[model samples]
Target: MRYSNYIGIFAGLLMIVAAVFPWISITSIDAVVTGFGSEKVTRFGMPVLMNLFMIGLTTIFFLVPKLWAKRANPFAAAINFSWALRNLLLLSTCRNGECPKTTIWLYVYFAASLILLVMSVLPDMKVIEKGKE
Candidate 1:
């Protein structure tokens, strides 16, 4: 837990970088999809932006040395992880007998989100006992 904050920060950065890479390529439409933009698909409505915002908040919470910030970090991280999962499931699935080709960057994004969640859950903190101190 001593390095959780640093690790979480790194993971957040990694997620941001991963978002710029191609996540999947739809063979049927001959289009490539990335986290920030889906040129041929507009219905997704920039799902990764929410994840980026949550990760940014989580990273800030990790840097803060307040009890309340530590407590709230996990919540943001969990939301980020859930959003990553949703993206993975939706993007990799086959539709109309055509399965999109998944890329390594997609998995990397999910892994970074998961790592951020774990780091947030195990944040290093000092809690004083009401009676002891």
Candidate 2:
């Protein structure tokens, strides 16, 4: 249970790393083109920044261990989860009947963010006192 915090930290870190890699690649019959992810996309890049910011906040929470930090962790996770879900949806859906094949990094990003979400939602375990029963 003590390590639950670490689990959230690990999830956040995973997302941070995944963000650096490509999330989605566009390919055609002739050649492959640029990808769109945290790194590649410029417009509407708040998700990328938010992901990093949340992870940084998570780290700070680990160090400070404040009540506020504990309360805020779930919100951070929710944001990242929605961001990742959006990424998945946008990448997978086809607008003009031509959906590009996604790359492995996209899945990685989703999985990492999903893990972070789950970790944040998990309630802290209560420690049982010895001979209490």
Candidate 3:
């Protein structure tokens, strides 16, 4: 399990770049951000705080070792899942909506985070199925 914490590391670094990159100076204000593929009103306009909050959580996971410990608190997974879900909700804004240049990068980062989160939470099938196999 020596290099076992890579998922959190990857998720964390991506989020850190997302949180502070471009220093907000070069970033676009009118960017579509991201959103799931849905016509519902809930799919529109996410506040900056939500995105920042995720960046913070993910950064914590990356910087804090306790969060990724084998027997650690489950809250980390939940938090990461929340972040991923939030990101997933925003994915379509990149492809389907009128997003700015930065939106694509943000979407990809979050999408990668979503995958990492999924990998973290799902029961490790190999460990669970070994005896059966």
Instruction: Please identify model 2 stretches exceeding 4 Å from their true place.
Output: 29-47, 123-133
Give the alpha carbon lDDT tens digit for every residue of 15-121 in model 2. 76766665554454432322223334354344466567767766666545556666777787788788778867866676566776666766777787777777665
What TM-score does each of the candidates earn? 0.93, 0.71, 0.42
Alpha carbon lDDT at 93, candidate 2: 70
The 10-residue segment of model 3 with minimum total lDDT is 22-31
User: Model 3 over residues 1-133: C-alpha lDDT tens digits?
Assistant: 3332466556655654554432111123432333322123333444334545654554455445452443332355556557656554544344434432444455555665665565454322224455684
lDDT per residue (tens digit) for residues 1-133 in model 1? 7999999999999999999999999878788889997888876657699997898799889999998999999999999999999999988898889898999999999999999999999988777788895
Residue 89 C-alpha lDDT in model 1:
95
Top-TM-score structure, candidate number: 1
lDDT value for model 2: 0.65
Candidate ranking (TM-score, best to worst) = 1, 2, 3
Q: List the residue pairs that clash in candidate 3.
A: 34-90, 35-90, 36-89
- Of candidates 3 and 2, the better by TM-score: 2
**Residue-level lDDT for 104 in candidate 1:** 100
Query: Which residue pairs in candidate 1 have backbone atoms (N, alpha carbon, C) closer than 3 angstroms, thus clashing?
Result: none
Return the TM-score for candidate 2, rounded to 2 decimals.
Answer: 0.71
